[model samples]
Each structure stands twice: as C-alpha cells, then as structure tokens.
Target: MIEKIGFPLVLFAMLAIVLVETNIMTSGIIITIGLNLALALVLTQILALLYGFSKSLKILNKTRRHPLYSPAREASVNAQLRSLKK
Candidate 1:
C-alpha cells in the first residue's frame, strides 16, 4: 500500500519542481494542485482497500454457510469405522 501511493507522490513532487523551475507555474498553484492530487490518490487507495475487504467478507460468509459434513461424507466415515471394527 505504501509503495502504491509513495511512488506516485514522489513523481508528482518531481514534476512540481520541474514545472516551478521552468516558470510554467507559480509556487502557490503548484502546491494546491499537488495537494489535491495527493488527496485524490489517497481516496482512491482507500476505496480499493474497502472493495477488497468487502469481497473477502463475502467469501468468508459463503464458506461459513456451506456445510462441511454432507450425507456422503458421513456414510464414508461410517463405512471406514465399520471396516476398522471388522
């Protein structure tokens, strides 16, 4: 997660520096844009994390509702027990 946001933030900072050096934008404007971009990136990361968490919860619920022991499994176990007794 850190790598996902950190790399892009580093690139944005470098770009802001270059833009400022080239006189393409003022410091205040660059700062504002950089902050907004960072906010957007962080929000996107949070949304992605939430989406993944929801998916995991859904899978967990499905597994919990599924029966671990069915009739066939019970029969198999009983057969093994009988064979052992014999």
Candidate 2:
C-alpha cells in the first residue's frame, strides 16, 4: 500500500525539481527536450529495478525456515528428535 502511492509521489517531486532547474537555467528547446527524454528513460529503468527489488523483498518476507529460528527453538526441536531416536 505504501509502495503503490509513495513511488510515483517521489518521482513526480524529483521530475518537478528537474523541470524547475532546467527552466531556471533557460535551457533551449532542443536541450530541454533531450533532457526530458533522458530523464524519462532513466526513471523508467529505475522504476523497473525498484519493482523487481520490491517483489523479491515481498517474497523473502513470506518465507520461513526452522534454521532461522532462535537457538532455544532449535535446541528444543533437537532434544525432541534425540528422544524419538532412543
């Protein structure tokens, strides 16, 4: 939920800053157009990269492992196994 809204908000803020900077510098039409295109390409690539990273993060958050449990949990489970062996 947070990621859905936050990413675009941040992108727009950054693009606004770049536009303001370019306008302040009085960039010519060709230069401004080129800059905008480059910015678009870079932002698209960044968004794609961020999406992949977030998806992997979501997957990682959902996974569970007994080895990752606390030492106390591991010890209890090990003791149970040893008793069963006997």
Candidate 3:
C-alpha cells in the first residue's frame, strides 16, 4: 500500500512553527515544542530511509538465487515453455 501520510509528523511540526511565528498563536509553550518537534521529525525521516534501504537490500540478497536471476544458460529448446490459451 502507498503511504499517504509519509513523514506527517515532520510536516505538521513545521507548519505549527510557521503558525506560531506570525503571532496568530499566543501560546509561548508552542515555540519550544515546535523547535524540538522539528528536530525530532527530521531524525524520524532519516531513520525511515535507512530502514527502507536495509529492507530492500535484504530482499535483493534473498532473491539473488531465484531462477529469473540465475546466471544465463542455454535452454534445450527455444520453443514456448507453455500454452497460454484459456
């Protein structure tokens, strides 16, 4: 499935900072929260990228021995391997 909310926390924290900066928000606590939040979200994205890369590497390693990935070899015949008719 696709990730519609990829890095949502990071985006929300950034927007919150923008909202707080224009005096539209009166809460002083949000400034500290937003700054820390932005840093945290940045780290989260980095970790997500690392995890995805690692997973892909593992999958590629596991699939390396599959028939489609085997070293090229001449077949006994080049005819169709099977009929596709219904």
User: Which regions of candidate 2 deviate over 4 angstroms?
Assistant: 1-28, 65-86
Q: Global lDDT of each model?
A: 0.78, 0.69, 0.70
Listed in order, each prediction's TM-score against the native is 0.47, 0.36, 0.52
- Which model scores highest in TM-score? 3
Question: Could you give candidate 1's per-residue lDDT for residues 29-83 as a string of tens digits?
Answer: 7767875676787798899999999999999688656778366776898899999
Q: 1 or 3: which has the higher lDDT?
A: 1
lDDT (0-100) at residue 66 of candidate 2?
37
- Candidate 3 TM-score to native: 0.52
Backbone clashes for every candidate come to 0, 0, 0
Clashing pairs in 2: none
**Residue by residue across 1-86, what tens digits does model 3's lDDT show?**
22666567567688778877777874767667777888887888799999999999999787776676643332322223333331
Candidate 1: residue 39 Cα off by (Å): 0.7
Q: For residue 79, what is the lDDT in candidate 3?
A: 28
> If both were scored by lDDT, which would come out higher, candidate 2 or candidate 3?
3
